[model samples]
Target: MKNILYTVLLVIGFSAAGTAQEINWVSLEEAVKLQKKNPKKIMMDVYTNWCGPCKMLDRNTFQNKDVAEYVNKHYYAVKFNAEGNEKINFNGREFANKGYNPANANRRNSVHDLAHYFSVRSYPTIVFLGDDSSLLAPVVGYQTPQQLELYLKLFKNNGHTVFKTQQDFQVYAEAFKPEFTN
Candidate 1:
């Protein structure tokens, strides 16, 4: 009976692991270099350490199996700390967290230049860039796996280009049948 119980536990563990999505997160510079080698859209998760919704996004939406797999396969995922002290260079310009205070690393610090450039006003903004490093969109706030799936599919499949108006997107969203299980 003990052996059977152990086998069942092992099976359940493996099954859970299989369903969990493992994301390969990279830095902005690394993602950009990789994009030059092989062109693909970039998905940047701009977040702050003190933001509760940002943490929830990391815990829920980013951990979703289908969302993770799709993002991993199609987009170069980057996790950018909005208040971090990291310097980033792109397109002959340098972006840095100039106002970052070491004393208050956990609390709200200075915003990164990149975040300012993108005009990110929210806690957790999912910024998508085109293959050529063009700004596609900046989606703000905490989005569920099912909610984010629509954007993922829209950008990955060039649905955004096709969606010229608000009505077009509304139609698409209304008709989209999400495959992600929560």
Candidate 2:
């Protein structure tokens, strides 16, 4: 019922039509491999299966047409399951969740070593990486399309590199003109 209503609203151009292409989410490893051929920043949606906000991020923010289009064009989107038992090869190192119990897959299993490497302790952290695959920063929690746009564009344009301090970032954020809708 909710999905149908959303589709209806989207078709009616609610927050700019919902008939947009979805983000081309690839695996982190695949993203790295693709980066070798085509240089682009990486936007990793590090989420856990049990997180409510993570699900909302997908349905409410990531589902937005503008977000999907912008991400697909300017970044290699990675939808990583933070607690899943997947082996990850990042920066010449292999990572895995040695403690992950398959039975607790949907109930918050052990954190993947890759999450630990990124210092992600939260459920839905948006980990940004440069074209060289270097960690830029992680924006924690759920963000609306407009809210996430700030970070998306900031990183996409290398705007995050100019901040000398947190206050500097606050000023830039305050002056940011968000172009993404819905």
lDDT of 2 by residue, 1-182 (tens): 99999898777885555456799999999999999999999999999999999999999999898999899999999999999998988889999999999999999788899999999999799999999999999999999999999999899899877889999999998998888877
Model 1, range 43-68, lDDT digits (tens) per residue? Answer: 99999989999999999999988888
* Over 4 Å off, model 2: 1-18
Alpha-carbon lDDT, every model: 0.92, 0.92
User: Against the hidden true structure, what lDDT does model 2 obtain?
Assistant: 0.92
Q: How big is the positional error of residue 109 in model 1, measured in Å on the Cα after superposition?
A: 0.9
TM-scores of all models? 0.90, 0.89
Off by over 4 Å in 1: 1-19
In the order shown, the candidates' Cα RMSDs to the true structure are: 2.3, 4.5
